[model samples]
Target: MIWKLSLTGMKTRLRDYMILFSGLAIAAAIFYMFESLATNKEFLEHSNTVSVVGIVFHLGTVLLGIITFVYILYANSFLMTLRQKTYAMLMMLGARTSKIAQMIFIETFVAGIAATVVGMVVGVGLTALVNRLLVNQMGIVVSHYTPFNTAALLVTLIFFIAVFLIASMINASSIVKKSILQLLNEQKTPTRFKRNPFLLFIETIIGLLSLAIGYYFLAEIVKFQIMGLAIALVTIILGSYLIFHSVVIFVISLLKKSNAVVFKKLNNFTLSQLSFRVRDFTQILSMVSILFALALGALTVGLGFRNQIMTFTNTAATYDIVLNNAQKIDQQKIDTLDPTLNVTYDQKYDDTTIYYIKEQFDQHPFEQKDQSVFLSGEVNDKTLKYDAAKMEQDEQAQKALQDLELPEQKEKQIKLISQADFDTLGLDESQLQVINVTDFTTILPQIKTLIEENEKNNPSLGGAEGQNSFSQKYYVYNLYNTFFSGFEFMGFFLGIAFLTMLASCLMFKILSSANSDAIRYEMLRKIGTRQSLLKRAIFKEIGILFLLPGILGSIHVLFGLQMFKNFLSQPYHNIWIPFTIFIVLYALYYFATIWIYTSIVLPKEKRN
Candidate 1:
């Protein structure tokens, strides 16, 4: 009998159930996606150069787990609300409370498992699609990464099943504890907007002060680092909440007292409705705003790093390739790049020391003063000294001589010899060639081939030696790939997950209250209020709700981006790209929420 009732109730509210199902599925899918990356040890090892990649993935897993848990609870609570009145009716018809609780548990558990199953399937698809997009967009080569993984599947299944079980129990218990009368009267319960002048004053002052401090800390993040981030996170979140709580109420109150605004059209009704719902709306708005900031900030930072990959590479080393004792094949490969500039230095090496002619260096200078610029000065004839203090003080000269080491050679003293002395040495001579190409990225394939050949010929210069050697083009290539595939990869997916979850939170929260709001709309309809006017009221009200958060969130992003300035040359570079994308998505959600809310409350027009 309980099974029959549960099925009937589900069929009756299939649309609402679909919303619940999709929300839960999205939560599950995002969790599964995160797990896919976290569980892929081989992929992490291959793609990331960061030492703490495991720790980063662990933190991400915990964060996503917490977010998914909270989302499931909220979604389940909405499910409970949708069926509460129906349960009350059954109890009044002589059904036992225990029976109803059993029915609720069965429905919740069944729906959860169904969503989780669908989510895992969708997760695989999303993993493939997102991975492809990242690879193409960022030019990263990820190996040993599969869209479907048994470990990820198992972890996702275990985590979501446990969450669903806990949620089902909580939902069933909450329903059973409430009396039938309370359940029936739940929608009709009145909500009030409270305003205490002294408290409001204090909150307003503190909120503004908190925001100021948070902004200051975020802007100066380089100096304070983690401590600054902690303070900023706390203060900004608190400030957002308090500011919304107090300021929104104050503004609505002012509008309520103004005859010019309140007496206009349906403005009075709108303000009254806002006043009643402001307390709840404030919390949602604040949360949504913060989530928006985080989502957009993540995407912006990720794209910033991606766009500046070449710039960062150039910063580390000026020349595309610097080869000691260039071979014929190497010169041939270098020629294929249509060399913009080719500078070679003549050198001779004896038993205890390597010598470079001073005149050769002066004639065609190839020393780097900075990351990109070449040094402009005459070379002095002196023995090269490896003084740590002197090298640290003269970073430009240190960087210029960074590629002094050669394969299978003992550490030897380097000296600048006169042309006459260099010619008289009779030691074996070699040429160190520095090649520059018009575009570094255009010749990456050839560069890789050349590097592999070099490493093969000189087995002593493999792995760490090749990777850390600034003179090797392979270093730039590897660094570029690692940066995009590591932190940037994580950032992009995190943004997408947060954006989906938070938008659903706002949509579900609004829709959950639709039934409670239905009676008021019906009352307005009976009193000759046109459906058109009602929609306009909804547009105004919901539009305000969307607008407030968007404005605040954008402001947060503008300030929050300052924190990345130390890491990035220009953190705000290409920021509008993410902002534009977010605005379009957010606007779509805004309109979709209104349509869903309107469908629940308004009557359909009759045909002639």
Candidate 2:
């Protein structure tokens, strides 16, 4: 009999179950993706920026895990609400509480396992898709990554199953303890704004200080590093809760005090409605806002890094393409590109350096360019002098060069020698193919391929000979861009996961209290409140609820993005693009929230 009841309940709330299932699956999939990169030292070993990337993915995993855990609690709480009244009815029908608790456990456990299986499948697919998109679509190569791992799968199942059991036990316990009368009255939440002003003031002060401290640490995150992040995390989260719970209530009360505004058309009703729910769901609102900031901020930083790639190339390379050991196929590919200025020459190199005579590059001097946020340089006729890559900066690098026992300075660089100097060296010349293009980005793919092939055929051109291939600036920049692309991918992927979970949390919270809202709306309607006014009121109330988080989140992100200024040349560049994306997403969710809320509250005669 319990089994039949559980099945019937599952069928009844299939839509809610679907949201929970998908949220769990995506969360697991994203976690799998991050762990694949973070734990795989062998894979991270390939990139120059491996350490930074590894830290990012590791932190990402922890963050996602925490948020997922919270979401599970909230989601399960919602599930319990769905069954509370039913459980009450069953108890009235002579069903034992313990037996009902067993039924609840089985129902939750079954649903969890089902979601886990489907989630694992989706996780695998997402992993493969993310890897492919990062490597292929971004014109980058992140080779030797495992998308589907047995350990990750096992971890996902054990973790989620444990979470489900705990939540189910809590849910069942909470229901069983409540008297039949309380269970029956679960939908009716009294709107009682009762609080001490002095206590509220003190809480707001503590909340502000906490937020201030968090921002301080985050601002100088480079100084504090991970420890700072931990501190900031604790403080900011606590502060956010207090701010929403205490600060927001005080501010809304001030608005309520204004008689002119309160007497305005439906303003009084909307604001009153908002205040009532705000007190009950303060933590939810705070968390929703924080998560929104994280989601929006992640995508913004990703787009910013992506945007910086093209800019990085603008200055990082003077000659768009540089090929050593010019093969016939390479020449054909370069010819297809139709470069604005192409130079094919020869140079001499031993173990430590590649050298070309000044006269060789004198005919068509390559443009020397420099770009930065504060300073910019124009293209000028400059002979090849410095190394294509940045000069080695540390004492250890110089010592390492000396230890290697290479030529004079032991600093591998492009050398400009006078003819007399070149004659003295007596080193054999290596064929060189170089090009200056008007537009490199358009044919970046062919250029990227050409550069990769050359690096593969001649490892000596890369560094101080015997080192990993670090080709010309253009190619290496693209490689760096690829690494950052992985960073971008991580951010974008995690953002989607957080957004999904947050939307689920907020929507469920709103809908779960819907039965209570129905009574209020019914009372209002009987008092001659038109459906249109009520709808506008509904829109106003929900809009404010949605907008509060958005505003708070915007504040978080505005300050949060400053942390990335060092990594990104212009962190705000094209920032509007991501904001637009976030707006669209938030708007869609907002309207959807209104629709769900309306359906539950209003009569069917005026749903449109």
Candidate 3:
């Protein structure tokens, strides 16, 4: 009997179940995609700048995991709400509470198992598609990495199943304890908004202060170290919550004070719905804002590094190939390439050197002094030394050349000059040769040959070296490929994770309080509200819900990028690329949310 009942419930609530299923599937797929990178120890090892790659992936995992957990819980709660009245009726019909609890458990477990199976399949397809895109963009053949990871699959399965079971148990217990009257009255009661003045005041002040502190710490990331990052994280989260809880309420209240405007043109209904929604959703709104900020920030940072790679490569040299410590065959190989290409040979010695200059009295007169300066204001006989030995031997003076690892007197003899001077020496610049523009389209095979030869001969200078050693030697590709690859991979994964969380949170809150909203919509329909107006109301409500978090998140990312200024050689370069990407993704989700919400809240219109 229970088996038939469960199947009927599943069929009847198929739409709601699909929402939960889709959310889980997206979460699983995104998680698998991320893990393919994070857990691939071999891939990370092969990367040139493996320094922060692990850290970035680790943080990405943590953020994604938190989002997944929150989304699953909310989704499971939606599932429970769909069955609440039925569960209540079962208890009222003399069915044992324990039996109903057992039924709820089986239903939830079944849903979880079904979602996981479907999600894993979707996840594999997404991973393949995204991985292919990245490989093509990067222009390097990455070994075919597996999309299906056992550990990741197990972890995702365990997490969702546990959450579903817990939610089902909570729902069952709540139903078991409630009086039949309360159970019947649940759908009719309206949830009231409670305002505590002192709490609001405290939260508002603290939130503003937290945001200020977070901004300060982020701006000075280099100076304060990891403590700054921690402080920024904590304060920003607190501030976001406070902003949603208090600042948003304050704004709405101010808007409500104008009686004429508040009630004008369906504004009253809009504001009332927004107020109720916001009051219940402050924390989730705060979290969503933070996630959006992080997703955008990751993309921005990746693009920034990519821009730096391009500019650094383009500006530093004028060649497709630069070989340092070359061999005899290497020269022949270079000569065989297109004759029009400019090949400049140069020698580079690995050494640590420094220099000190002696002052000439006539050229730099001692008496040309500015006595207004209290401390050593001018070049004077007493303060200025001409003796190189004296300058080098002085312990205080010698400290400046400590990086050179030479006797102070020996270090003083070295002077660095421009490449123009070295070229005049005419000795083959110790094995460093720059090959100027060969056709980019035709040069791939030749470049590949050069890379293989160089790796064979030197055994240390890996692959084809380009203009900037950093990009070619390190990133192993041109600027465009590197930047595009990183952006595509990171953006797609982060976008999926973020949108899933956003939709699930919005859906959860809307559906949880949906019984009340059903009445409100019904009342409006009876009172001659054009179905269109109610539809508009639904759109406006959901729009505000998505818009607030998005705006705040964009602001956070804009300022957050400032923190990277000190570290990146060209921080702001190509920033618009990521911003444009984010804008498109955000706009799509916004419209989609409105459509989804409308379908859930409003009934279908009648045909003429």
What TM-score would every model get versus the actual structure?
0.87, 0.80, 0.72
Candidate 1 on 6-32: residue-level lDDT in tens? 888888877767877886787677667
How much does candidate 2 score in TM-score? 0.80
Candidate 2 structure quality by residue, lDDT tens digits, 246-334: 87788778888999888887888777777775655787888888899899998898777777666656555556766666743446677
Kindly list the per-residue Cα lDDT of model 3 for residues 1-608, writing each as its tens digit. Answer: 87777778888878677767777777766766666555655455554443234455555666777767666666666576567778778777888877877777777778877877787778778767766665565565667577676776776667667766776677667656777677667655544555776788899999989988998999998889899999999999999999889877877777888888687767788888777746557877887888788778777776666555443444322245544445434466666776454433223323443322233212322111122221322212232322344444555434322211212223333333344554454332333334544454356667667756655655544333422234232233453445434544565566656766666666666656655676777788788888777877777777788778888888888778879875455566777887788778777767765665565567555201
Best by TM-score: 1
Residues forming the 10-long window of minimal summed lDDT in candidate 3: 365-374
Comparing 1 with 3 on TM-score, the higher-scoring candidate is 1
Residue 596, model 1: lDDT of 88
What residue runs in model 1 are displaced by over 4 Å at the alpha carbon? Answer: 41-59, 94-97, 132-146, 216-231, 330-332, 369-404, 463-470, 523-531, 606-608
Highest lDDT: give the candidate number: 1
lDDT score of model 2?
Answer: 0.73
In the predicted model 1, the residue pairs found to clash are: none
lDDT of each: 0.74, 0.73, 0.63
